[model samples]
Target: MAYRLLALDIDDTLLKSNHRLTKETKEAVEYVKNKGVYITLATGRSFISARKVAKSLKLSDPYLITHNGSFLASHVKEPVFERRIGAETVYQVVDILENYHCHFKLFHEKYVIANKTRQKAQLISRVNLQLTDPLFYPVHYVESPSHRLIDQPLSVLNIRAEFWNKRERRDALEELEESVTGIRITPGGKEELFINHESASKALALQNLASRLGIAPYEIVAVGADMRDRDMVSQAGLGVAMGDAPEEVKASADWITRSNDQSGVAYMVKEVFRKQLRIETPHQ
Candidate 1:
């Protein structure tokens, strides 16, 4: 089957252990790109973070479905689609998180608003900066973020906390689910919780993108590694999961490629296009 588009998740799906794109992955992506596949990034990262990885892979004029698909943009420009949580949702979310020992950050199109000016917030910023690639935008620190962010719609609310065990996280997840309306809370990463608008999702965002591009859902391929990636991966005609992906994500995938370190995407891409390439090759 010939897929016209590829929606790739970043983080563990594309980047390897060192949090960098491997040379083999780069060459494979460039090869597929040269063959005219429209490769785009669909990730939980903000636009700034997602765009950096897209450029690193040498994707030209990429369409990014970021902030868990709360925001969509092409070539890092204006959004083709966008979603934001209102102040009420933000305040309610903060209230739930206040009882816990977590550092909360409000995500916007251009800024990361840290909720507390205290030491925990400051420390998380430092740790995140160290863990992440060079930050692309400025983050403002405020003792009370809800007050300042009240009037603005936000891309996401990222909370950083330690996982003493699974139950701590499960309880928090249940609480959020029960307390909120018109909001979505997904805690996939080991130490972070990603919150977005209910209408915002990779599947919904990809549908919008596909409509604008005049592409059918069956003509697209989605590759991802997180639990949050389930929808997009399952919806695509060919859903691929990284070998290291969680069980649930793997269950949703049509096929599982090698681990990210082993160049899973490169492996999957070649296999998917191999048959098409053979058919198109002219007789010598």
Candidate 2:
């Protein structure tokens, strides 16, 4: 079946290893976009960070799903849909976080807040650097994260426990989840956790977009790489996993696209994804 909407996860799925859009990928996106395919970016990054890539691709009205689907940004100012972290859950998790040797952060509508002294802010800044030109996304340093969590609605809760081994950290995060309620936990890279409200999911966001467009999930395609991308990738009509994606993620997908370094987004669109749109007509 032909795809009416294309949901693409950034980072490892759309951007190359160096974190820039390749010419081939750009061309591919532009080509499909011109053909009236609705393309949008679904990512774990903030909307501020995701917008740079959207701008590069020249998508003016794309639904930029950011912060792991907690927020859906169609414009620069606000999100069409937002699922904030529960106050009690946030407090519970933050209270639990104090016991670990981790650097954590909270995402608000416009800025990111993290403890001033920790490596979380610096590390995230570095991540943004790789994704775009420097100064693309700025972070806010705060002395009291507790106050902010209590005072404002949060879009995401990120924890980075570099002190523990990757496996250890993942296990620890899983264990921590048992103590908290109404939260969704997913792996971020090797040693980080993306904790959000249970309702904040890429699948939900994709479903909302599909419903609004009067399209079914089977008519939508999603491509992604990381664990956080799993929900939407596996749940989409045609789930595509990048070649560089982990085996677990790759296994969950219906098809495997080329790696990002090889312009996988472009290749998939030009080859695998687009081919499904053609229908043979009966001739007399």
Candidate 3:
């Protein structure tokens, strides 16, 4: 069966290591888009970060699943669906992170609030120079407890404790998992953790899109890099893992493609829309 929709993961899957779309990828997406296949992005980033990539590709305002599926938008600045952590749960998680001295960033719809000094914020900015447009807004510095202005609906609660050892980080996560209810906790990176509402997973968001488009869950193609991508990858008819993805993530995929820098998105488009893959392959 042909895939009616293509759901792509943004970071480390569609975009190169430099966080930019390659020319080959761009041309391939354009080619397939011309053939009338639906293309959308499912990412761990916020709408702000995801839109930049969408704009670069010149997609016809593709559906956006952002904040690891906590928010879905039809186009930039137009929200279609949103899920948020409970206020009580948010306070509980924040308290736990504070006790463990874990650094974190609270993600609302409009901005990201972090409790760190200007110098530390600048350091983080330097590390993530690709996000030069101020992805994070630092507030007054704090040690044990950190609080910031929460203006809009809270979607994702991101905790970055890379400074701590693996054992310590895991221990803190375990504690949080035990304490928090109605929240989904996933490994964001080697040292970071993401806490969101239980319903705010890529699988749910994909299902929502499928329902809206009158498509089945198995009629879509999903791809990603990190373990956070496991749910959607397993649910898609065609699940692709980036070359640099973890062993678990790779195992969950129907196919493994080259790294993002090698234009893997372009490769998939050609294989699917161009009908280059054999009948036994996932795209078929």
What CA RMSD would you report for each candidate? 4.3, 4.7, 4.6
Model 3 RMSD vs true structure: 4.6
The per-prediction tally of clashing pairs is 0, 0, 0
Q: What are the lDDT figures for the candidates, one per model?
A: 0.75, 0.73, 0.71
Clashing pairs in 3: none
* lDDT rank order: 1, 2, 3
Q: Which model, 1 or 2, shows the larger TM-score?
A: 1
- What are the runs in model 3 whose C-alpha is more than 4 Å off? 75-78, 117-123, 126-132, 135-163, 276-284
lDDT of 2 by residue, 149-242 (tens): 6786454533333323565565568667778877787776747777878788888888887776677788778999888778788898889999
The candidate, 1 or 2, that scores higher on lDDT is 1
Model 3, 52-147: lDDT tens digits are: 777888875667888888888875457777788866667677777766534566666566655553334544553343232563432323443334
Which one wins on TM-score? 1
Lowest lDDT sum, 10 consecutive residues, model 3, at: 275-284
Give TM per candidate: 0.86, 0.85, 0.85
**Model 2 score (lDDT):** 0.73
Candidate 1 structure, TM-score to reference: 0.86
Q: Kindly list the per-residue Cα lDDT of model 1 for residues 33-96, writing each as its tens digit.
A: 7666778889877788887788788876677898788888974458889887876787787777
Which 10 residues in a row give candidate 1 its minimum summed lDDT?
A: 275-284
